[model samples]
Target: MYQVLARKYRPRNFNELVGQNHVSRALTSALERGRLHHAYLFTGTRGVGKTTIARILAKCLNCETGVTSTPCEVCATCKAVNEGRFIDLIEIDAASRTKVEDTRELLDNVPYAPTQGRFKVYLIDEVHMLSTHSFNALLKTLEEPPEHVKFLFATTDPQKLPITVISRCLQFTLRPLVVDEITEHLSNILNKEEIKADQDAIWQIAESAQGSLRDALSLTDQAIAYGQGAIQHQDVKDMLGLIDRTIIYDLILAIHQNQKARVSELLMQFRQQALDVSLVLDQLISTLHELALLQYLPELSLKYSAEINNKIMQLSQLISAQDLQLYYQVACKGRADLQLAVTQEQGFEMCVLRLLAFRPLQPNEILVSQTQVANQPIQPAQQPIAQQVQSIPQVDEVQAISPEPETVSAAVDHLDDEYYDDDPFNEPSAVQAIEDEQSSDDFLEQELESTVEPVQVVQAMVEATPVQPESNADQIVFDPSSDDALFGMDEELAATSPEQEAEKYNSDDFLFDEIAPLAEPALSEQTKIPVQEVKQPEVTESVATPPQDSLFDLSSVPAVDAVETSTVSTMPQEMIDTALMPQDILKLQPQVLEGVWTVDKWEFWFRNSELSPAVQELAQQGVMTGQINAESIFNIPKRYEALLTQLQHALEQALKSEWPNTHFQVNYAEVETTTPYTMQNERKAKAFQRASDLLHNEAAVKDLMQNFDGEIQNIQLK
Candidate 1:
């Protein structure tokens, strides 16, 4: 005996229908103008007034007081139609009668007059379910029905209906209701029913309906029963298994503040309550959207409670706008990754950790501005290790540090300097040098006992012998110059002979038949080449020492069979070491070439130069434009400008090593002339073409083509 709320509150007339004003107005207008279509079709989703409108139209046609859109409920015909008992109103569920025979049978009564009303109404509900043959059988009758008969069709899916059947009918489509429309309708229904309900609870039910009035009323009926009398917000939330709004808001705030522990605690509560974690991420994303709206557009309303609005405003200010966008994207991505995670709880925890991990920088970790960096003083870059090792102190600086005490070696050197105009290496002078060394030694011993401290003697030794002898025996050079016979000879020893000198120092060491460095030798007739006093360049103490990458630069060293080492007592170890080195290494890095440089020479040099692959490619791509003021000018395409700039310094160094005087200058420009790369490619292509033509003209190839019908499949140059 209990009628459900959906059925009890169903709209009966055109005026009573909710959220279908278009259909109602059209039908009302047709009735007022007396221009009603005989075949009527209503189409929409479930619970959107499709069947309801069709039934209302049926009542308007059957009403007693001349047919009208608003039929009087007091009439027996209207009452019978409302109660589903009108004889003339034949309602057919097309889903049940889909056979052509059933359609033909249904069309059997179309010619007859109305038994109880002015028109015979055939209402087919879910008409799309009818078979093709059934639709074909009904199409003719539906198009031209008798004067007193009307065909009414209603289907949720109008696309399934035959276009022929649809063409004969006047179709009206119904639209689903929005949340606000459903909510307002429900409130009015509840008010008329005199059932108390919370607005939030009603809103929850309306939102749950998803724009269907039937579902909204059905939920309202269930809620009324569940609440025993009055619907409450908490009861609705519990019924729907929704998390508390305040809890959701608090969880979001905890994540924003980087409160990991608090977030974990709240997540544990969610786990204990068995709430949907995915739904929580959805809510978080939604809340972030609202927060962004509040941040960028502060004037926009959130349509929430005052407390919720205040919380949103505070959070918008607390988190940076950039961070808000990052958090939103991270939340959305986490939601998608949830299904792939091993467990839902682990996935949710990881997502929360990400939100806390990618927060804005703290005060101490802020980046320094360019202005601050510019204000700080710049420090020089550290020299390479090899360069640092080569930086030896000058001889003057060594003398300044500790004043040189003239000892045996300094006395011998002074003797050479004083006797430069005469025979410096004569036997007498050598003997005199030995006698002076002996006298200096005796004086040093007497002073060592009285005034010369051991520390001062050690300092004198260090200062006197500035250059240490190399440990390698092969590094010693034979210089037939100074008193080689004076040093390390006792008083009882005799002077050396020229034959002994020649035997002691190898004859091959005297390569040039000219005067050599240091004091010239005045020995036997065998030593005819007088040693020339070559004045070496004076190196100032202020000049910085250049770096030497290696101890032995074989590029500058000449090929030599051997050099015999002989004791040169008077020669300073530094001068001996310099003389021992090859002529090229002894000289500083040469700056100027001996002759003019040519492009062909440069090309040959480039072909042989050892360069990296990228650097080599750069050289091949560049075209030598001209030589300007001893500089080789090259132009590379502007497209390769960046590459050229990067490899310019290295390529220039390679070029300079071959042509020292010619500077390599490269510019980025449109290279119109042929480069090495283009020339090489052209040469290769021409060679390939010539080879191919020679192969094609061969007799063996012609025989194979004429006899065996063979064709050349491919040609490749190896």
Candidate 2:
């Protein structure tokens, strides 16, 4: 009878072992040095040489050449072990005989001398499956077995075994073989068996085995029988139900080129095949991630086939890094949410739509400005300025007028008084001292005069003029005595009337000349201004004004009334009292409160609660989307996936503390419909709008604005 490939291809000696050179090397050294332990435990996942290595070690211990790493297979003892007829070597299936009586019986025979082989060998498979009583019975013998006997134990789960029993045995952990190693081994086996196999088929079997050599061999046997002798890529793909690489390549190409119909057709083709949509998406995500990585590290040697390499190279150049990242993220999120959908195809379709939605705009997709936008009638929501003010509160005209200032003081220093002065009547002297500062470049001046019209130059100068203070009587019209202090003037200069100001202005014509460029006015013939015919003040030659800046010294103030209002109160009476109204205080209680856990409330408590860094991050990224009975559904963005693994338990424990007997089901979502951060922002925006509307329509505010010509530049509510 033809034996199965898994059994037929099983390694007979250390040299035949496909992978795990570490295990082989250590065992060989131990056997060569004659330092063998009383009992050996081989631990690993299923089909990874746990029992095979034990059997090989059994033969090594019992060979006719004496205890050696290289067993002489031609001897009767080695032949018996290979043929499963060794009298001295007892192989037990611990899983089936997991009883105290069975272990006692086995230990009862442990002291016996070997009938044929040099030393008796006991090989127990699946040793962890033994009952607690059986373990207890075997513990003493496992720790101190007869010198003539060699005990070899193999188990898939060393963790399940009691530490007391594990401590007595020499343990070797066998690592799972990688795909390349498994594939190469299978290829060699096929060559030895003279079976024709394709590389793709062998690779598929290796991947499907998930690092179990026995499983790979078994899958290879199935593939050989299914193919009737020869293995092909198509047959393997059909058998495994894995979507073809061409399909992935075609789908990505369609997406990158923005061919919506082609993408749809590719997906339909996949759906017709009835392959797992989740796996397809996983492949897409993986491909996109690899493509993005390749953009930076082009020489990265990944395990993709040659047919895929060209597609990756082409798509890497076609899709930008940002687009690749977005596509990958969406694919990952879609795969995670695939189970929540009614059908796999629907979920995949939505994911594809999302990807298409964010696709870089094509030439035709770019919007062009049109004449219709200029001619289109404005909607009421996009009203003109007149209609905007129609809803505003109307201001009553003011009848009150304040007395004009007697002298120039600290207030009007910021005011420009040349030609387009705020007063409109305060033109000063056109002194000859100012005329000397004019430029002598007659040619350049003439060219400028011809190119720039005098009217345009005047308008430009007006535009460039320094901003003047809001010149109203509610604002102090005259500079305060503070200007006198700033100039370090005695009481003599502080009380000068307007006529002295005119004379002082006549004296300061050179100062005005420095600012002529800002006004650029046509010079007047008269050097002195016609002042109001009051008594000409006697010059106080005793105390000379410090300099021209002394008369205009308002440097201490940033605004006209900035210093005056430095200590002013913040808000109006009604607003202050309303804001000062005390909020209801909350007391910490031992028991959980019975209130609706809206996003607002959840965030309020979370804000006040002290939490660990990990749990707080999880809470911030996630939201309590729904609470169905005791189960609370929390969702985070897909990128914050670590929240589900490392921090999930801690986060759930924290939620239980707050709710006191609740469960949390956490999920990752693209967008949160309601979250504390969004809720707070909405409330703040609403509050600002209300405050702005109140300021605009308040009757008292309108009256003040009309009387004082005040403009409300900004209104903020906190």
Candidate 3:
């Protein structure tokens, strides 16, 4: 009979044990110093050398070399213990002898002396399986064992052990083996066995072990047998049903580049090969992690072939840090949600599609572009001129109007004279000043011509001109009397006849409104217009005239009478009143009241309710079964029991604000009735089918199908 590799390659002593130097050192020191405790306990996960170390300790205690850490196996005591035939070293499986009677029976022989060795050793494996009563019965004896007796307890779960029992024993916790340690151990075992194995194959076995040396050895044995004496990388991959790393790298690169067709092709290949999508997703997630690490920490080293490492470096540079993190999170979430998908392949494909769909926007992909605004055709004059001006090309129109810089200044002067002089209400003196301002036009022309760009000339021309185009060009024009026409003078001043105004020119009572409006325009244009002062005629009454320095003194002139009728008001009085209405007093549209919560109205409420997405999912999968007292009971599928409590609380919180008087209870059971989610899906399906029929009946669709032999593979509703 042949022994398995895991048992055959088991360590025989402390020195031979791997990945547990701390435990071995402590036990060795205790034995050498003669400070060994009466009771010892070992704790760790399975296949991590808990029971193995216990057996070795028992051998060290009963060896013929007088309790040495390194036992001489040739001695009768060490050989019998190694062969499991030592009379003094007892090995008991606690799982099989967990009753109090068995524990008491075992303790009855504790006082007896050793039959063949200097000390009696008892090793109990899986000691946590013992009943509570059994532990109580053995605790007093274990705490006060005879000088010649030793108790060694080994358990995978130390948490189940009583604190008192654990306090009395010397506990040693073992650590799980890492990949490198397991790989090295497996390599040494294969070398001793004279088995030829590829490095990649050994690495695969070690990784599959997930930090357990025993599992690694067992996988190695399977690989050897599956490969028929020689372990190969391809054989290992086939046996483990793992996709090739290069394929995974290609898939990642395609997704990062948003190659939808390439991703679909890879998914098709995965389907044909029957590869495990869950494993593919795990590998993809691991690769994404490596990419992120390389981006943030370029100096860090990764465990991959040189070619694969180069690919990682290339991908790190190609993908942004944010996009890489997003891909990683999506992949991890997809792996978790694989069970919820209709199929594993579909889940994996959607995960890759999500990565492609959510890439960062490029420089040119701004949400709103100035080009679109500039290209918009201007609306008619019915629209505000200010709004129309925004869509007009800025520099193009200015440059187009005056290609030559020499005429730019003259064109500006001509525009000014035409705009202001053409108005029927202009003052004679101001128009005369415009005519006189041409003397300095040559100097302005020199400045405008020297400018390099037409845009600068346009800017200078705008600054030189005063009185911008009026926004209210459509309003009614006022009557004569320079001050009254330009400054909106009071009607009383405009109503006075010229003969009466001349008679009252020397009047003592001069209204400030009349004098102030005349002074403001002169004050604003004092430098631009040169006016000579004129003295008034002699009068008996004291006349109120403008100040001595006042430009274009107008007190000598009398007020003119009003024109009986002014230009018609372009805006009607009704329109003005409506425009000036206060916003606070405006009528508000009434909102529809909520209807009663009944079985027929459940779908309507669910669709329109303001609930969180998580709570909505819970509500969608449920139907209102009945109402008990003030509490409404709902039944969801039993499969959602895992999420019942959390979703239940969210549903209640969302409903309490709307239906505060009624309580909600969610129960998990077999759903026999139709759910709101099912009804919604059915309605969507019907709508889609109706749309498809309408589309197919159209003349264009029929012509397209007949002319090109095209088929409708899918219908999408926006």
TM-score of each: 0.50, 0.55, 0.54
Compute the lDDT for candidate 1.
0.66
TM-score ranking from best candidate downward: 2, 3, 1
Candidate 1 per-residue lDDT, tens place, 1-718, comes to 9889899988889878999999899989999999989898898888888888888899999999878988998899999988889999999998998898998888887888888899999999999999999988887788788989988899989999988988999988899888778888989988998999988889888877877789888889889888997888788878777767678678778876667789889978988998878777777888888888888799985545577678778888776676678888998989899999998878887898888777654322322333343233322225333333233222212211222243333444544452444533222332221233232223323222222122233333333432423222222123322223112121112244545534433544332212222234432223444324422234232112222443222222211112323333245754443333232222222223224433343444555669888887877876664553356787778888888878888887776665566677767788676666765565456545544544554443543475457887666654
lDDT of 3 by residue, 437-508 (tens): 232223333223323233333334433434223222112222222322333322433555656545443343
**What's the CA RMSD of model 3 in angstroms?**
23.0
Q: For model 3, which pairs clash?
A: none
Candidate 3 stretches greater than 4 Å from native: 362-718
**On lDDT, who's better, 2 or 3?**
3
**Which of 1 and 2 is ahead in TM-score?**
2
| lDDT (Cα, tens digit) per residue for candidate 2, span 548-575 | 3332222222122222222223656434
For every model shown, the clashing-pair count is 4, 3, 0
Candidate 1: misplaced stretches above 4 Å? 285-305, 312-328, 334-380, 383-718
TM-score of 1: 0.50
